[model samples]
Every structure is written in structure tokens, then in C-alpha cells.
Target: MKLLLTSAGVKNASIRTTLVDLLGKRIEECTALCVPTAAYAMSGGPGAAWRQISGRASTPMSDLGWKSLGVLELTALPSLDADLWVPLVQETDALLVGGGDALYLAHWMRESGLADLFPSLRDTVYLGVSGGSMAMAPQVGEEFVGWKPPAGGDAGLGVVDFAMFPHLDHPDLPENSMADAEQWAAALSVPGYALDDQTALTVVDGAVDVISEGNWRLFTP
Candidate 1:
């Protein structure tokens, strides 16, 4: 599978170019399914959440040059079943996962059976933004998001080998600083990457590449 795990979602030219290349066509010709379920999971509601998340996703999604299929409530996918939603995913060129509650998103992706289908979609690009990126890892540090995991380690989708700590040194989210990232990395059992808004981690097949316009660091034991 082709993956573009970004901190802020196509914030730099290199990342955008990479995504367009992954599509293997002009941006205007492709269509994407924007999964805003993570954002909805953060809202802690089943009803009013959609309205809130859709509003938040508009601007960042516009930067992704394709006709969006609006929002797919991945949290609700389990009950809906693949017979209903699988076609939508199969038809779309990519999955643009918006950022929010990483753990919550990870839960639904597994439960909804989307995780099972992802690996099969080798030709489809999977673009994850912030929390979306974190959800794709085996496990991630929740300190940056001010959330506590269970007493034991919390597992993510396990789609990728490394854990990600995004928004490093972001002035607005001071908790997501380089110092905080270092602290988070120290506790990680697996390899970790600390990425700022201008950076992204791209995985095509088994190879990994870092695309950056600002700052990024890798910590490995």
C-alpha cells in the first residue's frame, strides 16, 4: 500500500507532489474518500459530531486536489457493513483520513473492518493527517494529545512499524514541542519519528522516506 503519513496534510510542495504521484494521474482526475471519523470520535457523540468535524475538515481537504466523497463515518462502518461501504472505498483512488482522536480512530478502523481491507487496496493511496497518521502505527505516545492510555500499552492499527509524534515544535500547540517529543520518544519501545507540520513520512511498499520543509528527527533503539 502507498501511504503518506503527514503531520498537517500536504503542507509542503514535496508532500503534495508525492501524493499526486501516488495517484498515478492528474489530481483533477482522481476522487478521494475523506474519512472524518477520527474527528467525530473526538466529539464524543454519534449525532452532532458530523456537523462539527465536516466544518473543521473543509480547508485542509481542499488542499488535496480531488473531488472528495465528503465524509465517511468510519466509526459507524461496522454496523453498516462492507457490503454497503466497501464499494465506495474500492471506487475511490485514496483514503484521506483527517486528524483527531488517534486511539478512538484506531478502535473503529479495526472494528469497522476497514483495517482488513486496507492492505488489499495496494493501488489506493492512504493519506493520514496528524492523529490520522498516529492511528496507522503499531503504537503511539498520547502525551502530545494530553490523553492517557490504558495502564498497559495501547495498540494502533499496526499498519506501519514506527510510532509517530507529530506537530513537534509547533508554537500553537506548545505541548507538542521538541522537548515533549524527546520525552515521548524515550518511553517508546519501537522506533519513533518526531515530525513538525512541514514534514511527512511516506511509505511505498516496504521503503520509507521522509519529506520535509522544516524539522524532523528519528529515534531508534
Candidate 2:
């Protein structure tokens, strides 16, 4: 699978160039699907979070030159079923997944059967922001310093081998600090990546590359 996972969407020239290169075309020529399901999971039935995610995600894309952008409300999709989304997803050159509550996003991914479809969509460039990145991993734990959601079962989709903790040291986000990331990593059984706002991890054909304009670190179990 080709994945560009970021704390914040495409923050630097290096990352933007990488994306354009991966698309095999200029940003303007590519078609994309913006999924704000994660934001919905945290917004609690249509509010500020929901309103902000799409624009926040798309504004950057527009600035970068992507002309064709489609917003997808997974909950409103014919069904959460992959069969329903596969054709539409296949038509897009890439996917832009917004972030909010990781577990909430994971739950929908599973319920909609999207988690099971990821491997098949390996050819599609998947760009995940914040919670979107974390939810794709094998396991995602307390992303915030003191915020823990109810526990019952698996916490993530397990699409990727490692866990991701985003927004490390971001000024506006309280849960986002390198120290908190380390603490969260220590509690995890698997390896993890801690990324600041300007950093991202790009995975292509099993290879991982760190793309950063800010700072990031990795933790091993």
C-alpha cells in the first residue's frame, strides 16, 4: 500500500513534491476523495469539528492544485460496505482522511468494511491526517495525555504494522507533546511513531520514509 500519514496535511515542499510524484501527475490532474468520518466520530452529530475538517483538509489540496475533490460522508454512503465504495474509491487517484477520534474512525472503518478493503486499494495513495493515521495502525492507544476512551476490544484497524501518535508538540493541542507521545508509546506493545505537525511517514511498497520540516521520533517496544 502507498500511505502518506501526517499530523497535519502536507506541511512542506518535500512532502508535497512526494505526493505529486506518487500521483504521476501534477496535483491539479489528480482526483481525490476526502473522508471526514473521523471528525464526525468526535463531533457528536454535526458541529464545529465536522464543519472544520473538510475545509481544513481541502483548502490545502486546493492550494496545491487539486481541482477535482469529492467529500464523502461514509455514514451516508449506500452502506459502510466496501462493495458500495470500491467502485467510487477506485475512480479516485487518492484519499484524504481527516482526523478526530481514532477509535471512532476505526469503528466505522470496520463497520463499513473499509478496513478489510484497504489491502485491495494498495494502488491508491492514502493520505491520513492525525487520528486518520493512528487508526490505520495495528493498535492505537491513548493519543491524548489524559484522555482515554472506553475500552472493550481492538483499538485500531491493524492495516499497518506500527502505531502512530500525531501532533507531537503542536502548540494548540494539549495532548500533543513529545513527552506524552513517549508515555503513550511505553504503554503500547508494538512500535510507534511520534510526529509533530510538519512531519509525516510515507510508506510505499513496504518501504518507509520520514518526511519532515519539523521534528519527529520513533519508539520501539
Candidate 3:
């Protein structure tokens, strides 16, 4: 599957170009599934996360747009039963996983039996934002460093071998966050991509490429 791993959303012009470039003419053709991490729905109801993408409540798939589907309002583990989540993945042409807590999303994907559904998602393009990008990596480092531990290891979906360090230079981050990312990347002995806000890492057929207005540093083991 094709992956559009952005540092953040498609806000900046350069990031938009990156998305459009990777998406090609299929931009509108593909269905975008916006999978919100647990943090996205911490306070609001299930429909709240859905509104972040489509600007409307999470109703039938047809009501959203473009013959596609998006999965929002994913808070608790039990909420992702086959009745609710499976149909969306089965019907969609592609999926866009938004940013939040990467570990939480990974755990939910497994507990809800969603990880087992990957093979069936052959036709789906897997697009991911910050936290989503981290989920595609082999490991995200200290899973419980910032939040409480979920059920599993920091192990990601393993869609890609490289580990991604998102929001490298985010304005809201502490001064040492970037340094911490760099150190983590070095210790892991894996290829690392440092994505500043508005940047992206686009992977297709195992090849990795960088896309952004800002700079992205790559670390090789």
C-alpha cells in the first residue's frame, strides 16, 4: 500500500503539494479513513472526532463524501467491534490515520482485532499523520514515557521498518524534545526520519522519500 506519512495535517502549501504529489490523480478517487487516536476523543463523544475531518456528524458513509469512509469517535477498545470498524475498512479505498497518541491507537488496533484485518486491506492506501506515522514504524520508543502504558509493546503495525520522530521542531514542544528524538533515533540503530511540522515522509513500494517546506533529517543504522 502507498503511505503518505505527514508530520502533521495538510495545512501548509508545501505539505499539500507533497500530499497531492503522492496521491497523484487519485486524490479524490481514494476514500480517506480518518482514524483518530484515543486522545482525540478524550472529552467528546464518538461523533466529535469524525467532525474534525468531514465537518459533519458521523452518519452513513454516503453522507460524508466521495464514496469513501472515515472512522472517527474511536475512544474505548470495545467501541471498535467488527460491527462498527470492520465495515468501514472493508468498504474504503484508502485510509488516513490522524495524529494523537500512537501507542493508544496501536493497542486499540490489536485489541479490537483490527491488526488481523490488515491483509484484507490490500486495496487500501494507508495514509498517516504524526502519531499515525509513528504507528507505522517498528517501534515508537518508551511507550509509557508520556502517558500510561497500553496493553502491548511500543511495537507498531510494522508497515515500515523505519521509526518516525514527529513534531521535531514544533513550537509547543520543550526545548529538548528534538534532542531527545535524535538520541532515541541513534540508540535504536534504525533509519529515522525527523519530520518538522508541515513536512512529510512518503513511502511507496518500500522506497522512502521526504516531502516538506522544512528540512527532514534521516538517520541510518
Best by lDDT: 1
Kindly provide the TM-score of model 1 when superposed on the true structure, using C-alpha atoms.
0.89
- Model 2 segments beyond 4 Å from truth? 43-54, 57-63, 78-84, 143-151
63-164 in candidate 2: lDDT tens per residue? 355668777666666445656667888778888887777777777776666666678886788888887788888778754322233565446877778888
**Per-residue lDDT over 1-221 for candidate 3, one digit per residue giving the tens place of the 0 to 100 score:** 67778766554766555555655544556676667664453446244455546645322112324445555444553654567667876776666676667776776667667668777676566667667678778777762234435554567778788888877777777642667777877766468887777677777778887777776788787
Worst-scoring 10-residue span by lDDT in model 2: 143-152
lDDT score, residue 37, model 3?
A: 63
> How many residue pairs clash (N, CA or C atoms closer than 3 angstroms) in each of the candidate models, in the order given?
0, 1, 0
1 or 3, which is superior by lDDT?
A: 1
Can you list the residue pairs that collide in candidate 2? 80-112
Cα lDDT computed for each candidate against the true fold? 0.78, 0.74, 0.64
Which pairs of residues collide in model 1? none
TM-score of every model versus the real structure: 0.89, 0.87, 0.76
Candidate 1 lDDT over 4-28, as tens digits, reads: 8999888777888888888898778
Root-mean-square deviation per candidate: 2.8, 2.9, 4.7
RMSD in angstroms between candidate 2 and the native structure over all alpha carbons:
2.9
Q: Model 2 compared with the native: what TM-score?
A: 0.87
Off by over 4 Å in 3: 17-26, 40-51, 54-69, 72-85, 148-153, 176-178
